[model samples]
Target chain A: MFGLIGKMRAARGQRDAVIDVLRETTGALPGCLSYIVATDPADADAIWVTEVWTDQASHKASLQLPQVQAAIAKARPFIAGFEFQVETHPVGGVGLPASEKS
Target chain B: MFGLIGKMRAARGQRDAVIDVLRETTGALPGCLSYIVATDPADADAIWVTEVWTDQASHKASLQLPQVQAAIAKARPFIAGFEFQVETHPVGGVGLPASEKS
Candidate 1:
């Protein structure tokens, strides 16, 4: 599985801007199998994103797009902090379904 | 937000048992606002779980139940590995809906 997770804190006034960018750019990515961005309901500043890509190469290519760059730049001013992690998971086993598991 | 996420790998022989327990026990938990269990479609060995509770006290209380214990015990043989992380999320931010966001 191609998984990339990013956790970021939005600036007090920039939550909307970040979410808007996330929603748009992720949808545009070619290999984006799943793009999920969620804000911590309890805290406005905290944001978490989980993305599943077709492959690592496609994911890297998406990062080079102008829209993605623009989105990140626009979000920087309003973002308090951010962390990114990528994991390559092997397939084959019994697991839970999205709706029932989370 | 009271969020408890657990990632576990189930044995080939015991996938059904684990899923059964998760479904049953989560439904019985008193303060369980949300309980999600999902398998990585690409990888059968990978399981991702997301749980949102009313509070830590209630979550801890639920863990003490016999059914929960029995379920975990029964599934232990088939589980390759498991990791648990509980985070206390402070409220007040913009987040995405479960369906639209994911």
Candidate 2:
């Protein structure tokens, strides 16, 4: 499986708005096993996003989806920067579909 | 929910060994909804661990578990460094238990 872990910083005082856009736009994407958005404890303006997909191709394709594009557009103004964008190969784990377990 | 996202760098040529230790140790912990270990694609010696727990207390308590301690000890020799240890409050996501969904 493909995984992505990244941190995103929102513009000053716009963290909640960025999160709202993310929450509304994410869900039920094809080949997505998990997509979690979280609030950073140390940095109020930072958010972390963790995602698992069936494959790298699936993850790439999802970005081209209309909903995702719209969400990016909607959130662009509030997005300050992105950091620690690491891609990963998930071997196995809880919460993943049984088929994904090694 | 509580979430943790971190990067762990293993000693040279020990990434797989570290991953094995983590995979063996993580599972069925109390209040743990998800614990995923993935290999970093860009760095052979780096691994990314993403975790979700029912609450902050559960995550803290998990460190005291015998299995967790054992795993930490076993993995320590190969662990070179840790980075980007970010704590988060999970709002909602797919693959999380239905009850955890906001």
Candidate 3:
């Protein structure tokens, strides 16, 4: 599994825009299994995105894409500082099965 | 997939213990696919746990297990307030595949 964790701070009125960008872009990614956007319920300015990509290559490919860069650029001014971490988890090491019913 | 997200506060001296409990207990769970414990690089008191379980049942089982409960009980004193979110992701909805070569 490829995991990414990012933190961003939204500008006064850009919170909705940032969320919309995240929803549209990540939701359409081909290699995405799941992309979770979490916000500090108490602080609308703080946001974190958690994404699982099919592979590092796909994630890397995403980074090189213009749309992704544009999204980042758009959000940069609103963001305080964001760090992204890409990690690979061991397979069959006790992960939930894809077909698990519940 | 079964995912768990938790936030915990660590006492001044309990950082290592919290990490140890996470490493040892989660590493031993039969249904654990991956259990990630992340700390704010700048703040020793803040911690986040992201776990993927084999299934919802397995995750629930983990919660009911004595060791798991005990671990939480031990950490509760130091935690300000922790909330756990259990979410199920839509499988094959563009998630990273388990056997991804990269």
Per DockQ, the best of the predicted structures is 2
Q: Write the per-residue lDDT of candidate 1 for residues A1-102, one digit (tens) a residue.
A: 365545688878687677777776665577655554556655667776655555678889888899889878877777888753425331211122243222
Residue B39: error of model 3 in Å? 0.6
Candidate 2, which CAPRI tier? medium
Candidate 3 clash pair list: A32-B94, A32-B95, A33-B94, A33-B95, A94-B32, A94-B33, A95-B33, A96-B54
In terms of lDDT, model 1 sits at: 0.59
Clashes of each: 26, 0, 8
Per-residue lDDT of candidate 2, residues A50-97 (tens digit)? 999999999899999999999999999999999768788988777887
Tell me how each candidate scores on DockQ against the true complex: 0.14, 0.80, 0.14
lDDT for each candidate structure: 0.59, 0.89, 0.57
lDDT of 3 at A57: 79
Which lDDT tens digits does candidate 2 get at residues B1-102? 999888889999999999999888776889998888898878889888899999999989999999999999999999999975878898887789888888
Tens digits of lDDT, candidate 3, A1-102 = 555555567777676677767665664665655555655555566555656555667878887788888877876676655544424331212232353211
Clash pairs, candidate 2, are: none
Query: At residue B57, what lDDT does model 1 achieve?
Result: 83
Instruction: Give the CA lDDT, 0 to 100, for residue A95 in model 2.
Output: 80
Off by over 4 Å in 2: none
Please provide, for model 3 over B47-66, each residue's C-alpha lDDT reduced to its tens digit, 9 standing for 90 to 100.
Answer: 66666555678888888888
lDDT of 1 at A84: 39
Model 3 bad stretches (over 4 Å): A1-62, A65-102, B83-102
